[model samples]
Target chain A: MSMLQVSGASKRFGGVIANEKISLEVPEGKIIGLIGPNGSGKTTLFNSIVGYHPLDDGSIRFEGQEISHLRVPEIARLGMLRTFQQTRIYGKMTCVQNMQISKPNRNEGLMSMFDRFPKEDLARIDHLLEFVGLYSKRNLLAGDLSFGQQKLPEFAMALMNEPKLLLLDEPTAGINPTLINGLIDRLKRANEEMGITLLVIEHNMRVIMNLAEHIYCLAHGEMLAEGKPEEIQNDQRVIDAYLGAH
Target chain B: MRNTILLVLGTIIAFAVPFMFPAYQNQFAMLWLMILFALTWDLMGGQMGYNSFGNVVFFGVGMYITAVIQRDLYFDIEEYAHVAGRIDALTPDQYLTGIFLGMGVSGIVTVLVAIILGAGILGLRGHYFAICTLGLTIAAGEIASGIDYIGAGSGIVTPVFPTELMAKGMFFYFVFMVLAVGTFLTNKWMLAGRFGLAVNAIRDDEDKAEAMGIRTKRYKTMAWATSAFFLSMAGGAAGNLFGFIDPINVAFAGATFGVWMVLMAILGGKGTIWGPVIGAAIFHITQELFWTYLFGWQRVALGAMIVGIVVFFPQGIMGFLRQHWPHLFGHKVDEQTTVEQGATKESEA
Candidate 1:
């Protein structure tokens, strides 16, 4: 069975229909790509899946449980999490501190919050920070980092949660070319070695084609196509709508 | 080791102040009360980034709760109203019991009010939240003034403290001191743990914090409730200390205590643990001095101070210190990277 299944998902922002009856599936342990033109409901679908907002119509089943009605933190606790196109880190906090708080222990009570964090988790946090090439910068305030470098800690932060499926929106958007391959390698290792599934939204064709096992294309709030990498690359509809434009 | 030394030194000074200057015992107590106010205010305003203008509601509510409980426990309302300070003083045991019970009940009731109020008002963000809280404070003051049971516009006098126990000023000075220290230590402990990280996360970017599974709403509510708990207790003690509980001027006192709490936090550098403590001490001492020396123009001097704080020291004294001397706060600064970054920034600009 699929790890995530979204059926008949629709979201409307008043006069604008952000997403319309979008259906998709991501089986466990697979890397899925979502590619679309801007405002084509790629993000809206991700938002709906991760429960950022309630869906007007649809069912999102994550690990065989309906999750559409849940709130963001609740959905996150259920082993699914997402990152944003524009990176968001706790600016006032050190990168290490940011990673420390992002652990998936949302159900811990107020009393437990007062308890000392396990020493083992600190080791894991450092390991993940090193994985993202941020070991040296871990002690620095996240706001002081350049815009492109901020994405690395955010990725590491999501990894700290150990989510069953990770959704990344434009992870490579702000990052420089030299770091993109390293990020891709980390994302792949997170999928294969750590056993976390990935559903990515990427505008960069090279990165998507290299990373995603299967690709879904969206256009004007509708699912335009879904195929393997070469098939998606060759699809006429994808070319005319998105790829050709680029 | 250094922190421990400072803590011990601070405690000794706190205990010695009332005996050293007997005449300024009331002023010293007010100092502690001001510290309590700033600390509680910062829990929401500085830590959680919820700038509530209505925390004074809890303060006023606590004052009324404590005074009413104290009055209702040992005295008849009709007789007490007529001769509040003049007749039927409680024994030392009764006085102690009444005040402690009043404070306990007020703290609990105020926390419940905060949870209920926070559920509604915390959903509003930014300036809307601020305005809503301001409205809540004004509305609470009006409601308190209209309630005849708690002494409407004229206000009610608290039961007089029996001289048999100790000097009123000295007794309450220690009380407020304990209250303030307890608040400070409690804040320090929580901020050292996951609670601190969670609230700071909420302050930085609430949406992302929520998405990261920090339970932003619950944390926000908890912070507000904690603030309410302490402020309410302060109110209870403050009412007895002042010997009266007037809704607007004394209990609620939005324009004075309410505004001062926020100012103190900002002036101390809101988000830091020691910021509120320093801000409260400096602001309170300065205000007292202005009251003495400036006489009728104390308000003008205060206005100038507030303006100066905002214009020259927007980040507060602590923030200014941190920027110039990061090592003081144990923040490691890479001199090489900083200079390189500065050069790049200048070149870019």
Candidate 2:
């Protein structure tokens, strides 16, 4: 059974059709790729799947449960989370504090908020920061970090929640080309060693080919192709419509 | 060691203020009330990032509730209010017991009111929240005036304090002081924990905080209710001290107290624990001194002082001090890296 199943997902921003009958699936513990040209509905699909906005027509089943109607925080609590194309880190907070605040605890109460945070929480946050190669700058304000560096903490923050299915929206977008391989390795390790499943959105074809086993391509708010990485690379329509456009 | 001594010395001086200047007992009590208002307002404004223009609503409701409860607890409130200006004086015991019981119940009732109101209102963002709260305060004042049981237009006088036990001002002075300290300590405690992180997260980017699975509404509503609880108690204290509950003037003095609360927080520096405290102290002292001593030149000096603070120290006194003395607060300075970054940005541009 697939970890996530989206069928007939549709989203419309008034006059703009952001996603039209978009559908995809991610099996448990696999690293998958979503690729498209700009305005091709890949990010829109990610948004709809994570419950960022209500889908106009769709069913999103996570762990075989329908989740299309749920809100972001509820889906997050259900062990699914997503990062943004434009990083959404707390700028004023330290990178470590950002990592800490991003942690999802099921215990919800007013008085409980005052209890001392467990020491192990900080240790885990530091460990993740080290994994992201940001341990030295953990105490620095997140806003002070370079764009690529900010993305590292943003990814680590999603890990803080310990989500089962993680969505990466252009994770390596602004990163230096030389450092892209390192991020890809860390992401691949997160899937293999941490037992996390990843559904990634990427524009860089070479990077996705190197990272994702199976790739789905979208163009003009509709799924254009779905294939193995080499097959996607060879598909004439995928290249002419997307790779050639880039 | 030096910080501890200063803390001890500050506490001693605070407790001794009424004794040092007997005539200023009422002024001192009012000062503490101002501090209480600032502290409560900052819980949402500074901490939770919701600037409410109508927190005065809680204070106003608290005043009327406390007064009415005190009157009704032993005697007929309707009869007492109808009699107007002349109360069948309570025996000293009844007055003390009634006052304490009234305040306690009012605090609880006010908190409940805030939670319900917050559930409905905290969802509004930015100016909408501010405007909704402003509308609430206005509507409450109008509603309070129409009700005859609490004295409609002319206003109702409260049960007179027992002047025989001690100076009326001193009794109220100590009452307000305790309330002020309680509010401050409560705020300090909440802001020192995970609650503080949640609050700052809401303030920075509420959407991200929500994405992190924080029920932003829950935290916001809780912060508001906590703020309402203290503000209402402070209102109850003010009503007792002033000996009257005029719907618009004393109880719901939104124009004066409402604006002052936000101003004090901003002036002292919003978001920090000490900003509101220092702002209220500086503002209250300056306003009182100008109004009393400077008399004819009061308005000019008051305006000038506010303008000076706003323009010169926009971040508030605490923020200004933090920049110059980061080491004092244990903040590591990184000016060299910052300057290099700035130069690199210039070249990039």
Candidate 3:
């Protein structure tokens, strides 16, 4: 069964229709790729699905419950999480601190947070830092990290609440090719090893083709095609859309 | 090691200075009060990044309430000083109530005022918030002047204490200790809590903090309230120390006090836990020395000092010291590391 279902979801901003009745299903435990050209509403769809924006018309069901009107943090608590197009790690914080902010119990009210979880959490932080390959630079401010290295902490942060479904928005936008490959491998390992579902929005066709089990193409805020990676590559509509044909 | 020893020595000197230099006791007490006031201002202004300019409102309120209770109400205590007469005249509860009433009334009034002002102005970002608060101080002064019962503009002179000088000295010391300790603990508590994290997050990026599940508005409101509580308490203590109250004393001087506190915090280190205390000490000392020695051009000299500090020590004294003496001042102080560590642990799990 689908873990997340978006039906007839539409969002418009001052005459600009960012998403036009975009409907999609994200199955549990599957890696799905969302592909679109610039301004094709991939990020908008992601935002709406994750409750960052209210739907102009229609509904979103996460874990079989309507969550269209829920606040972003409420949705996050319900085990749905999204990463940003731009890395949003705390610049002055250490690599491990970025992840700790995402801990479910950290927000368990102020009194309890103080009473419990200072020393134990600190130790857990060290372990997580090493896990993310940032143990050596754990003491360094996150802003000082290279662009590619920053994404690792960002990814780690998204997983803070141990979400079942994770959304990545252009995860490899400005990073080097080597880091891109490394990120894909890490993401794949995370999915296989931890049973986490992944939905990625990417313009990089090669990375999506390698990482996603299924691909959906969007143009002009509407779905153009959906199929397996090879099938998507060979689709006439996708080629025409890429080639600027109507 | 050297820093620890220096701090210890500083504490010893602070304790002994009043006793060794009898002529400077009043000066020392005044400076200590200023330091406490500045520290309170910095917690809300610098550490929380909310730049308040109406702290004097609470200081004035505290002073007035304390003055009214100690002089007007408690003067009856001396009138019935004969043990049997006093016992027959006033109930124990009545005396206790009067004491608490002074503190409670002052605290509540200040908090209410702060709330009204904070609700209206805390939504403003950056310098606008500061400016609005500053304007409120002037408005408050005018309003206080109109209140006849509270002695309007001419001011209310407090009755002299019947107690010995030693007792007054001890009272000042106790008050100073409470304010200093309160300021220090509150600063530490904030920096070590989720509220602190939220404030830092808000300071770094408001939109991001909201997106990250932080209720930015709620946190900001709480910060304002916390600031109001301490500020009012400090003001009440000051009122008792001075034994007087009036519109100008509470409101006009409050505005200046607010600015001075902000300056001290910025001069020491805006957000650091101990920065405000350090800034307050340095600022009060400099101001006292300059004002006492310079006579006529003291204001000009003080203004120049403020400008010089701002320009030369943008990050304040703590930041300057850290840069110049990393070995002495350095510690694991970055906020980002804790955030990253939290994030990484979740991914691994």
Q: Please give the CA lDDT of all the candidate structures.
A: 0.89, 0.85, 0.73
lDDT of 1: 0.89
* Per-residue C-alpha lDDT of model 1 across residues B12-104, encoded as one tens digit per residue: 988888999999999999999999999999999999898989999999989899998988998788877666767347777878888899999
Could you give me the TM-score of model 3 versus the true structure?
0.83
Cα displacement (Å) at residue B228, model 3: 2.0
Which residue window of length 10 is worst by lDDT in model 3 chain A?
Answer: A108-117
What lDDT is obtained when candidate 3 is compared to the true structure?
0.73
Query: Candidate 2, residues A14-80: lDDT per residue as tens digits?
Result: 9998888888889998889999889888888988888888999979999999999999889888999
Say which prediction, candidate 1 or candidate 2, comes out ahead on TM-score: 1
- Candidate scoring better on TM-score of 1 and 3: 1
**DockQ (Cα-based) per candidate?**
0.40, 0.35, 0.18
TM-score of candidate 3 restricted to chain B? 0.80
C-alpha RMSD for every candidate: 4.8, 5.2, 5.8
Top model number, DockQ: 1
Off by over 4 Å in 2: A243-246, B1-3, B81-88, B296-304, B323-349
lDDT of 3 by residue, A72-163 (tens): 77777677888889888777555655656656532556443233237776666666565566666666667778877888777776665577
Scoring only the A-chain of each prediction against the true A-chain gives TM-scores of 0.96, 0.95, 0.93
